[model samples]
Target: MRLVIAKCSVDYVGRLKAHLPLAVRLLLVKADGSVLVHSDGGSYKPLNWMSPPATLRIVSPDDVELEDGVISQWIVKSTKADEQLIINIYEELHESSHDLGVDPGLIKDGVEADLQRLLAEQIELLGVGFTLIRREYFTAIGPVDILARDSAGATVAIELKRRGDIDGVEQLTRYLELLNRDPLLAPVRGIFAAQQIKPQAKTLANDRGIECKTLDYDAMRGVDDSASRLF
Candidate 1:
């Protein structure tokens, strides 16, 4: 990774046009040819960025550019799309490169998968008499987060997310549609479970006759503590 703090102006052109006036900002260039322009604030989100599968070209300013006091110009062009980002650097405050070798990739801890596993162990949370059949129930599209049976012996196909958005609801709907096709699992119902569910997602799930569940992860973990000690 290469990091640069520079007095620069940025221009983006593609589906929409945007401009960042001259200021000292952070420029991150990743090994994958992705470039991110960031301000000091805004959490992890960048001010502007060109995703991977892009190319970066840096060159000294030309006569016209030099006349305007531009020292260097960097152009990042997307290979996958029609997007382009241009940065005109008048002065560089700092620059450094780090040789961090290949990453092992993210190891998530308390994400949706963990939530699904916890919910499967505590199936009764779904309702009294509820029992888990299995986790990652297989389907043609993908694995359903959890497959369980309700109190009345009805099949329940659940989709889990850390934050329930409309997309998560749509995913559960697809799984339910596919699962309902199987003769034995026919008439399968869906439950969209998450730690936090968006209002729009809840509305959509309710409209589709699918139940929305907000899980208390810490409470569920507390329930699991005793079980873990037994092993």
Candidate 2:
């Protein structure tokens, strides 16, 4: 991963458009062909990011851009969509690269881990014809808790939390945004599953068109228990 700290401005072009004024910020260019722009804060979420399968290219500033003091331009284009993130570098503060080998991936623990396993096995709990694709479905940002196909066969991305809150909803939103960019899952929907979902989180999830599901930990575990065996 290449990490660059620089004074830059950003513009996103595609279905939706946005702009970030020039400021000193962190730029992450990952080996996966993804680029993320982050400010000094805002927790772990990047201000703007381009998820892989994508490509990054650096070009000298044009005369007009150069006159404005832009030293270089980084263009990140998504291979699967019409989206691109353009970063105008005005000054380089620091830069470094790290070799992060194949990741072993995050390990879920406690009840949350059990929930994911149970849900995958009893996917019908989601709906009559729902079928689980897999647990911890890989994405550039992170692994989706579960990936499934709904009754009609549309792709579904799920984010599981022990206690569903606004943060979980936001996380799921990011996953859906990235997942839907892939042609194979262009219309992926989302579900926020947890043992207890807060009112605020439920409201936010509903506002974002993400369905919310309450998990029954004990019931699910009970279903997993072995039935009586004949002597």
Candidate 3:
């Protein structure tokens, strides 16, 4: 990553046009071939950014710009789109680069794994007579988060998420399709479980015949499950 603090102006040209007047702001030139212009304020969101698969070139300012005290320009071109972000540089206050290697990726603050474990230990939260079959029930595509059986002995595939979205619902649908093909687990049903589910996701789950269940993480955590586990 290359970080620069400079007094510059920015202009974006593409499907939309945007401009940022001259000011001392931070410029981030990432190793991924993307560039971001950020001011000190807007939380984590960048003031302007070019997505990856882009190129950046530093070229001397034009005669008119030079006469106006502009020194150079950083031109960023998106390889995947018609987007362009140009930064007009007046002066660089600081600049540095660093090599940040591999990233393990982000885990949700509430922890999806904990949610899975908690739900597994409290399977009855799903319904009155539901009992857990197993956690991480393996299937052809991937492991279903939780597998359980209702009072009638019908298999139920549950996909748990911290914040449920349409993708989670689709994932559960795929699991159901695969599980139902097995004679032993035939007539498998699906339950999309999450702490909070989006309205659009809930609607999609209902349309797909998958029940949506909102979980109360705090309530579940309050219950001691140490004795319930075989560990």
What's the number of clashes in each of the models? 0, 0, 0
Q: All candidates' TM-scores?
A: 0.55, 0.89, 0.52
Scored by lDDT, the top model is 2
What lDDT tens digits, residue by residue, belong to model 2 across residues 1-231? 999999999999988899999899999998888898999898888899988889888888553445378899888999988989989999999999999998888988678888999899999999999998999998778999999999999999988889999999999999998787688887999999999999999999999999999988878888544355353
Worst 10 residues of 2 by lDDT: 222-231
User: Number of the top candidate by TM-score?
Assistant: 2
lDDT of 3 by residue, 24-98 (tens): 999988777878888999654568777666899888855334426678888899786677998999999999999
By the TM-score metric, which is better: model 1 or model 2? 2
The predicted structure with the larger lDDT, 1 or 2, is: 2
lDDT of 1: 0.83
RMSD vs true structure, all candidates: 11.9, 3.7, 12.9
Give candidate 2's error at residue 64 in angstroms: 10
> Model 2: what TM-score?
0.89
Model 3: which ten-residue window has the lowest total lDDT? 61-70
The better-scoring model by TM-score among 2 and 3 is 2
